[model samples]
Target: MKQTQLCTLVKKSEPIKGVFDFTVEAPAIAAEAEAGQFLHILCGRGVFLRRPISICDVQDKLVRFVFEVKGEGTRELSEFSVGDKIDIIGPLGHGFYVDNEKYKHPAVIGGGIGIFPLLKLSQKLYEPLVVLGFRSADRVMMEEEFRAVSAKTLVATDDGSYGYDGYAIELLGKELMESECDVIYCCGPTPLLKAVQSLAAEKNIDCQLSLEQRMGCGIGACLVCTCKTTHEGMDENMRVCKNGPVFDAREVIL
Candidate 1:
């Protein structure tokens, strides 16, 4: 069940250059939200389409989401101040599977804004290793937050501006070569996700991927957010909002 609520904005901050973090007072959504789930937010009047933002954290009666201002809708959301009421419908979408006890030493990897959903998953895992990638130092966000929840955290940048001087997947590949992990969990751009998926397969490691897609309705009724799936011996298109924003690496066509 989904509820539409006018949530009070509690805190808004730009942790990095263009990204905005919003914490809102929405006990129902927070209480029910799972890691990798997202909220459909009404930015403001005249913005016909609600923006889908992934849940970054859930604490007590508050839910936090981090997003980069990519257009007028997000720019309007960024302008909202504390005490403002933001209309939201959530916690929507199928989330990451965190209870598979088969995965012991899991590696959580994310890129750019994709790191947002992994935060809550990190909090639930038992000291999983975290790896994050950014285009440069100025684009990096959530290092300390991931560090707080992870046993170890690694950061990589495309340029040599911060941390390792390459893609985070390089670091992840090196880690896999050095040691063994039960599984790999990831969310990122299509290129990054593809690379991670390939690497995981090369190493014979179990992996799960969270996909990002343009969505019309946050629920499956719209049928806009679909991905190719082959999980149940059926090769078909699955709704990301209903079937998953997360899918097994082996089952998804990527």
Candidate 2:
């Protein structure tokens, strides 16, 4: 069920320079929330459009979300204090499908801020192997949290400042070749997603990607968040906020 409520901010943290992690007291939203769905948050009185942030996790009666300050809206959002009442409309959009029986061996990958949405997904999967990518060591976040849920956690950085001195997707490729991963769930920037898409295609593996698209109305009333896709030989524009933020790698035309 969709909710438009004045949720109270229960917790807040700054993991990096501009990145903010916030948890709100919204039991209704949390109860129905799933991995990959986003919250449409009205930053303040001056901000016209709501900022769509991915659902990072959901506890008993709290919903967690993380967002980097990219613009004025997000900057305002970051200024919110604990106990502040926030106007939010969410558990919006489609989320990743969790089917452990059909997918015996699963691997999950994420890069940059895209890593946030995969946390809850990792909790749902059956011992999913988690691989996270970053620009360098300082960019890495939430290693302990992922390790708590996943069978094993791997890290990679573009510079040799982290675990594996290469793209995390490359490490995933190596792991796939050496071990067995029947299904892959990935979320990242376009370049990273493209690489994972190609790698999954080459290995003939089933892959689902969570997209980061610019959205206007998080509920799909407008065309602001549409992405190119092909299904059954038919090319179409699909609303990321409605049809997906998650899709099969083969179907979404990256």
Candidate 3:
């Protein structure tokens, strides 16, 4: 566990009202943290527990986290200013693994806040196709970033206020069947995950998924983020904060 200062803040979106991007100075964690690892951050003084957020990006001396201020803790985080010091412990959970050869032409599917984590993965994909979903045009984000990294980028809005007029999976599903993509990765709502799982099954395609769960310990110790999987066996409870925030698509029940 390590404690650090909230070095800076970058406001990346006006789309989702309370979302903000935080850039913290955590050289040690950044040195060891991989693309899919997450951080457990405490945004305020005397907060009982920290919030587990995915590590958005990691570089030489900094780690980034893109978060939505959905509740009290995050709301508190939103108020923090530059040079404010906060308690943080992490590079906590497991992350998505990239197999450039096997995933030559890969596709990333993200929904709402879920899109945040996928951005890091895009940096590693050789030629990626990113499909992001939002409720409306006002909610859409990261289009330019995806355009910058991915070979092809598509955006979909539930209400047709942005890119395509449909759900992300619907658009991605159609595109997956028609494209020469070798693998798929996704992070989204439960229903969307189910749909992606079903489609991947039908195609016998390899897919990886990142899960979001309420957590206590951002490490494996508390087992707070336990999830079912069929990977190594039929009855196994995997810890999301440890074993993965990322998993093989077919292995996860959802």
**Alpha-carbon shift of residue 14 in model 3 (angstroms):** 5.8
TM-score of each: 0.97, 0.98, 0.93
User: Can you tell me which runs of candidate 3 are displaced by over 4 Å?
Assistant: 1-16
lDDT of 2 by residue, 133-236 (tens): 99999989999999999999999999969899999988998898788888999999999999999999999999999998988988888899999999677999
**Candidate 2: which stretches are off by over 4 Å?**
none
lDDT of 3 by residue, 138-175 (tens): 88877998899899999999999888998999999889
True-structure Cα RMSD, model 1: 1.0
lDDT (0 to 1) per candidate: 0.92, 0.92, 0.82
Candidate 2 CA-lDDT value: 0.92
Query: Which candidate would rank higher by lDDT, 1 or 2?
Result: 2
Alpha-carbon runs more than 4 Å astray in model 1: none
Which candidate gets the maximum lDDT versus the true structure? 2
lDDT of 1: 0.92
Backbone clashes, each candidate: 0, 0, 1
